[model samples]
Target: MDVKETAAYLNVSVSWLYKNAVQSGLVIYRFGTGVNSKIRFNFSEVEAWVKQQRVMGG
Candidate 1:
């Protein structure tokens, strides 16, 4: 999904997704070139990551 869609899905700010999710090595597909590059995410991968981040019972 696009930045807006991703942010809404994650319930986070767009900048947070860029800084944390994208910058921290999460996979992002880039379209176009140079300054026009666009980023997209795989929802399944994102959902898996979210599941991985979940804390188990204490």
Candidate 2:
């Protein structure tokens, strides 16, 4: 998914994703270089990462 779509999927702001996605462990796919580039996320990988963050209820 693109930045907007990925942000929507995570219920986060686009700027937050740009600032934190990599440092927080999510992967990003970039196509081309420079200001006019496209980025995407592997939907399943993102889902897996989120799942790994799950905590059991008390």
TM-score of each: 0.83, 0.90
What does candidate 1's lDDT look like per residue over 1-58, in tens digits? Answer: 8988988988999999888886655678889999989999988888887777779998
Q: For model 1, name the residue pairs that clash.
A: none
The superposed Cα distance between candidate 1 and the true structure at residue 53, in angstroms, equals 0.7
Worst 10 residues of 1 by lDDT: 18-27
How high is the CA lDDT of each candidate model? 0.84, 0.92
Error of 2 at 21 (Å): 0.4
Task: Output the number of the lDDT-best candidate.
Answer: 2
